[model samples]
Target chain A: MRNWCLGVLAAFAMLVGTIMPAAAQLHVDVTQGNVQPLPIAIPDFVAATAGDETPAVNIAAVVRADLGRSGLFRPLSRKSFIQKITNINVPPQFSNWQVIKAQALVTGEAAMQPDGRLRVDFRLWDVYGGSQMLGLQYFTTPENWRRVAHMISDAIYKRITGEEGYFNTRIVFISESGPPTHRIKRLAVMDEDGANPVFLTNGSYLVLTPRFNPTAQMIAYMSYISGKPRVYLFDLETGHQQMLGNFPNMTFAPRFSPDGNKVIMSLEKHGNSEIYVMDLRTRAVTQLTDNPSINTSPCYSPDGKQITFESDRGGSQQIYVMNADGSNQHRISFFSGRAGTPVWSPRGDLIAFTKIEPGSFRIAVMHPDGSGERVITDGWQDEDPTWAPNGQVLMFTRSYPNGRADEIWSVDVTGRNEQRVNTPGPASDPAWSPLIQ
Target chain B: MMKFSNAIKFAAILSVVALAGCAEKPKAVPAAPPAPPAAAAPAQVKTSSIVPGSAEDLRVNVGDTIHFAFNSSALNSTAKATLQRQAAWLQKYPAVTVQVQGNCDPRGTREYNLALGARRASAAKEYLVSLGVSPARVDTISYGKERPICAESNASCYAKDRRDVTVVTSGGATS
Candidate 1:
C-alpha cells in the first residue's frame, strides 16, 4: 500500500512538475454497503441570481430523484436541514450535516447567464472528513434543465460509488399493445427513468430487438419491412433508416460491436442460421459460423476481441464464445436449462442472460467462464436482459403466462433491489444506451 | 397477401353490429375467435391484397396448415403428408406464388423463436419443393410467436401455435 501511494505521488509530481506528499486517504469500500443505502443530504441549491429560485430547487429535486430511484442513496428530507446555506462557494457546515445522520452532502448553485444558457455549479462533500469530494460546472440551454441536473447527479454518484452513473443513459425497446396473438410492435426510445419517450417507428411494420451502439449514435434492429426479417440501422440524429446490407434470406438479433464499426448478427440461409459480422463502413459481410445449427444473439466482449452467443449445435440452447474473427468457438454456459440472449457486462466480468427451466424463464448472470451462476429475478417469464452501463444493474421484461401484462423491471446485480421500470404501457425488448457524452 | 376466414369475417360483422350494445365493455384484449365459428361458406371477398382462388379452396379442403412438435421444426410423417397435399394443390395452380408463415409456441425468447419460426417455414418450403412444387413459387417468413393461431397459455394452444401455414400471394384467379 505504501509503495502504491509513493508511485501515485511520483506520477502526480511528474504531471504537476513538483514534489508532493505521498498520502493515500481516498477510497470507498463499496463492498460492505451493498445492502445499506448511503445516507445523503441534498439541500435546495442556492440561486446565484435573485430571480432563479425555482430552477435551483428543481435542480436539487432532480438530483434527489435520480439518486433515490437508483436505490443506492437515501436523500434526507430538506425539513431536517439545520443550516441554511445561501451560496455554494462556501464550504458546507459539516457539523450540522453530521448531526442529521448524513454522511454526504450535495450543494450547488444555478444562475441565468447573459448568453441565455443556464450555468450549474455543484460540489459534493463528505460530512465527516469535511472535504469536497466532487466539483464541476455545466453550461446548457435554458430548456435543458433536466440534462444539467442529470450531469450533477452523475458527478455525485461517481464521487461516492467509485463507478460511472447510468442516469444520463437511454433505453431502446419495443412498445406493445393490442391482443396477445396479434400485437402492434413499435420502436421506442426513452431516458433511463422512462421520461421523454419517443416512438421511432409507427406500427406500419413490425420491429424487434433494438440494440444501441454505445460508441456511436446508431441503432441496429430487425424489421419485417420486405415481408421477411432483416437487419436495419437507424441514425439517431438524422432519423435515416437503411437496410444494413444486401444479405441472405433472413437476418435477426443484430448487435453492434463494442467499437461501433461492425454489427454482429445472425443470418439464416437454406434453413440454417449462423453468426456473421458486417463492417459498417465497407458494408462488407463476413460469415463467422458455418454450422448447421442455429447461432444467434452474438454480443462482443468489452475489449472487442471475443464474442459470446447462444447456439444449439450440441442439442438444446447454450451460451458459447468465439473470437472476434470467428475462431475457437466454445461453450460458456452448461446447465440443466436452456440459455439465450447472453449480454456481456461493460466491466467485462459477468454475462447476463435469460434462463429457461421446466416452467419458468429467469434472468441470470454468470462469470465470463460460466461460474458463479445466479438468478437475479424469480421471474415467471422474464426475457431480454440488458446491463445498466455501469454493469451493476440488469433490466429485463417480465410477463405473465398469457403474455398479456409485459413490463420492464430492473434489479441490481447482486439480486437485491428488484423494482419495476415504469413505462407508458406494455413494453418489451429493452436495450440500455451508453452514458450520454 | 393476407386472407380472412369466413368465420372471422362473420364474427367481425357481428361484432360491428353489437358494438352499440356493449359500448362500455372493458375490452383490454380483443375477444378471441371461439372454435373459429365453424366452417361457414368461404368469404370469397377481396381484402388487403388477397384474391380468392386456390388459397381459399386449399384452406377449406386440403388444410393449408401443418403442425409441429414443441421446439422442433423437423417435419414428421403427418406433416409430410400435409405438405404433399399442399404441393399437389399448388401444382394445380402453377402460376400462383405463396409464402409459408412459420410460428412457434410462446415459451422461448422472442428473438430465438423468430429464428426457429424461420426454420419451420423453410422446412415446409423444402418439403413442398421436394414434392414437385416449383422452388421459385414458395417464399418463407417466420412471425415467431407473434401471430399465434391460439392465444391461451395451455398445452393445446401452444400445440396449435407451433405450426406453419401456406398462404397464396399472387397468381390465384377466381373461378
Candidate 2:
C-alpha cells in the first residue's frame, strides 16, 4: 500500500511538470501574437428544406467582402472549407478552421416562401472558445436579401467589438469627374461598401458637402443650382428638394439637426461666417454663434440640446462646442496645429475632424470635451472625416501624390483598422447614413 | 539695313518731337512700360519677398516659383512645358540654378492639400531631373494654398493658383 501511494504521488508530479511548461509557453505566445484582424469564415447559406425558389446571389460573398474590407476581420476563403454548410445538423469542423487560424465562424441557412419572402437563420461561433456567440433569424422579401446580409454582418461586428457595426449604413457623397479646372460634382448615395450607388443629382453645377439626416432618407447639402450658395434639403423618397432659407449671404456646410427638424449651416454674410440654425417647418432662424472669426461646420448633438462647430475665433481654426440655444461656449481643441470640420458623432460621444501637421494630413477623433485626441490616419493627404452610424468608425477622403485618383477611406475609433473603400471614380466628402429598413 | 536703322532714328526723333510738342505723348509711351513694371514689381515683390535672398537679384527662391493643381501631385501640361523651357535655359547657362515651387487650390481639406502640394513639387523636380536638368540645381517646396494670386472663389483663380513657377537663380552672376 505504501508503494502504491508513492507511485501515485510521482505520477501527479509528472503531470504538473508536463502541463506547467506547456501552459506557460502558450501564454507567452498569445501575448506576443499580433492582436491583428480577427479571421472569420462565413459559408453560403443552405437552401431551405421546403422546395423554395429564392435566387441566391451568393450573398455570403458580399457579406464576406463587406466585413473583410472593414479591416476588422480577415475572412477565410471558402475554397479551404472541409465541410459543406448545407447540413445544419453538423456544425463546422472548427478544428479545420483552427488549423487555418480562423478565430470566428458564421453559418446561415436561407429559404424561400410561397409568398416570395426569404427567411434566413444565421449562427455565429467563436471558434477559439468553441461555442456559439450569437444566433439570429431574419425574414425579408427575396429582393432584400442583400440588406439582410449586411444586418447580419453588423450584428456579428457589434457582438465582437462592443461597438455598433456600420456595415448596414449608407454614404452620401459628391461624385466627381472631368477636368481639374472645372470638374463636375453631383450628389450621390450608395451602400457603405460603395454598392448600389445612385446619383441624386446630375453633375450640372457645383455641389459641396451633402450631409444626411439621422433617418438617412433626407439630405442637407450646399448647392449652387440656385446661382447662390444656399442650403438645400432633399428627400430621397419623393425626389423633392427645397431651399432652407433665403439668407442674403452664401450658406456653406449645411447639416441636419439631430431631430431632423432644422438645418444647421454657416452663413457667410459681409465677410463673416457664423453658425445658424433654421427650422425647416417655420423657417425661423436662430443664431448659435456670433463670433467675428470664421465659424462653420455646425453639427448638432444627438439630443439637439447642444452644438459643436469649427471656428477661427481662437486665432486659428479649432473646434468648439456650445449650448443649443447659443450659450456657454467652450473651446475643445488643444492640438498644436489647426483643426477644422468638427463633425459631432451620432452617438454624441466624440467628434471627428481633420488635423494638419507639418507634411501630413491626418483624420482624427476626440472626445466632446476635447480630450482623448487621437489621429487615426496619416498619409499624403486624408481629410473630410465623417462618422459611421455607430460612431465607432469614420470615413474620409484620401488623396495620393500620383494625381491619379482620390478615394474614400475608413478607420475605426480605436485606430486599429484603416482601409480604402473602392469607388468607380475619384470620390470625396463621404457622409455616412443610418441603416435604412 | 540702312533703311531699318534710319527708320528707327526717324521714329525716335519723331517720338521726341511729339513728346516735346505734347508732353502727354512721351508720357503715354513710357507710361505703358512703367505702369506694368510698377504693378508687376509690387506683385512680384510680395510673392518673391517671401522667398529668401534679395529680390533685386532676380533669383526667385523655390518658395515663390512652383504651383500645383487642386488635389494633384503631378505637374500639369503647362507646368511641364514651362519646365522644359526652363531646363534648356539652365543648360545654356550651365551655372544657373532654379527652384520649383508647388501650390494647390483651397477646395480640399488642408492637410491633404499640403502633402499633395509637396508631392506635386517633388514630381516636378523629378521630371526636370529626367529631362537632363541637374537635380542639384532644382529644389522643391510646397505652399499648399497659403498664398493665392486671386483669392476669390472661382475656377480662374484656382487655375492660376495651381501652378509650379520656376525661379531661375543666378550662380552668383549678375546679368
Candidate 3:
C-alpha cells in the first residue's frame, strides 16, 4: 500500500525559500477560553490547463471544508470575493479583501505538468500585515488531490495557530449496524474528515477497539472469532490479519507502544485479567501486571517511561499509573465517578478517559498526576476517547440516550467546539492515526 | 430404576430377535418383516418424551441461566439453587461438556465489563466443580456487554442482561 501511494508524492521537493522574516500579525489564539472564528477568504484555485479545472475547484473546496470544520476559521463565500485570482504569483489586492472583513487569504493554482504529474502551489497571506506567511509547491498524481488539499490545509492551519495540524490523519473505527442485540461490527478506516471510507473486515465476526500503531500501517483490535475473544493484528499494507498469540485464555484491550515495537494488552486466566506486553519482532511476551483484579486499557506515555491503565484493585474501577516495568503502581484518579479506558495523550500532558457517572458516561481528561480533571463532553454515553496526533483534539464514541444510534464525535482539548463526525453507519471505538507520511 | 428397566427390556428384545435369526437357515431365510411401525412409534415417543441431557431439557426442565446483581459476581441463593440443578444434570451425564458464558448489562465500560463477565463465568464454573462436576468438563467465555439478552434501558431488562448461561457443547442428545 505504501508503494502504491508513493507515486502520488513522488517529489515533494521545496521550490522556494519558506523563511518569512516579517512576523505574522494575523493569528488565532486557540488557548483562549472562547475563540472567535477568524474570517478568511479562499477563492477557487486557478486552473492552468483546461483538463485541470475540476481538480483545482475540488482541491480548494476540500481545503475550505477542512479549516471551516476546525471551528477556528470562517471561510468567506466565494461570491463575496471582489477580485478573482487568475494568477497565484501576483500579490493579492489587499483593499478588496479588507472590505469584506477578511483577515487572512489563501491563493493557489493547479496545473498539469509535461511529465504527466499535477503541480499545486499555495500561498498563505496575512491580509492586515500585507505579508505572505507561507508558500509551498507539491507534485502528485491527479487522483491524489484530496491528500494535497489536506497538506495545504495543514500548512495554513500551522501558520495561523502556531501548532501542528491534525488535518492530514486517518481514523480507524468499528462500523456497527443491525439491532443493538445483534450488532454487526466491521473494522473500518477513513480520513480525519470522514471521507473515502473503506471497510477492512467483512463483519463476519465482532470487532472492537481498533488502534493504529505510530506508523498507521497496522491495526490492533479485539475480535470474537470462532467464539473466542482474542487480540489480532491487521496489516494495512498487506491486507492480512493474524492472531497476536496462542494464549490459553482471552486477550483484549490492546494498544501499541509509543515506539510501535510492542503491543500491550490484557490476558484473562481463571477469571482474572492482567496486563501483558509482547515484542512485535521476537514475539516475546512479558507480564506487566500480576494483580488478581481487572487491569486493562494500558497505554504508554509519550516518552515510554510509564504506563497508565484502568484497574478495579481499589474495589472500583479507576485510573492507575505505574512505571513501564510495572513497578511502583499507584492510583491517580480520585473523583466521584469511576474512570476507565484511560489513554495517554501524545503530548504527554494529559490523559483522556471515560468517566462513568451514575447514569451516564462522559469523556474527561486529567493530568498525569490525576489533578485538574475536566469533563469535555456532555453526551449520555461518550467513551473510547482517542487523541489526535497533535493532542489538541480528541475523538470518541457517543451513544444516544435512546440507545439506538452511536456516532463518532470530536472536541478540542479546551472542551469547546464539539461536533459530530459523519460515518456511513453507527460507529464506535475510534482511534485517530498519526499524520500520514 | 426406570432407565434400568428400559435397558433390560431392550436387551431381551434384542436376544429374541437374534435367536429367531439363528433358527432360519442363512441360504433360504427371507428378510425379516420390518418391526411394526406402531411398536417403534410408542417406544420412540416414550424416549423422546424427555431428552434427559439435551440443551432444551436443560433450559426447560432445569434452569440454564442464572442472574447476577449489578457488578457483583457472588452467587445468590436462587442462583445457587439453579447451579445445583445444573451440576446434578451434568453429573447424570458424565460425558457431557459445557461452556459457561458470562454477560453484562450496558451500564459499565466495555473493557471493565469484560473482566466482570469473566468473573461471573468462573464463579459459576467453580460452583459446579465444587458440586463434584469435573473441572475438565467445563469451559468459560465472557461476552462482556456485547451480547445483551435485553436491549432496553430499564432496570428489569438490565437485570436480565446481567446473567451467566450454561450451554452444553458436546455429548448431549442431538435433538
Lowest summed lDDT window (length 10), candidate 2 chain A: A11-20
Candidate 3 chain A lowest-lDDT run of ten = A13-22
Which stretches of model 2 miss by more than 4 angstroms?
A1-34, A49-57, A93-99, A128-130, A401-403, B1-104, B107-159, B162-175
Q: How do the residues A1-437 of candidate 1 rate in per-residue lDDT, one tens digit apiece?
A: 11211221121100111122322233444333346788889999889878788889998998999888777888999999999988777776789999999988888888998978777777777777777766777767666677678767877777677888888777889998888877898998887888768898898889999999974368899998777789999887778898888875888989998888999999988778899899988989899998888888999999999999999898999999899999999998887889999999999999999999989999999998999998989978988899988898889989887657689999888787788997878999999988877
Candidate lDDT (C-alpha), each? 0.83, 0.69, 0.89
C-alpha RMSD of candidate 3: 8.5
State which candidate has the highest DockQ: 1
**Candidates sorted on TM-score, descending:** 3, 1, 2
lDDT of 2 by residue, A66-181 (tens): 77876767789888877666654455677876887777878777777676667777777766666666777776766566677787887777767666677777788888786444
TM-score of each: 0.86, 0.67, 0.91
Give the runs in model 3 whose Cα sits over 4 Å from its true position.
Answer: A1-21, B1-50
lDDT of 3 by residue, A1-437 (tens): 43434654473735444434445888888765237899989999999989889989999999999999888899999989999999888888989999999999998899999988889998888888888888889999877788889889988888899888899888999999988889889999998998888899999998888999998889999998768999999998889999998998899999999999999999999999999999999999999899879999999999999999999899889999999999989999987679999999999999999999898899999999999999999988899899999888899999865358689999988888898998888899999999887
Candidate 2 global lDDT: 0.69
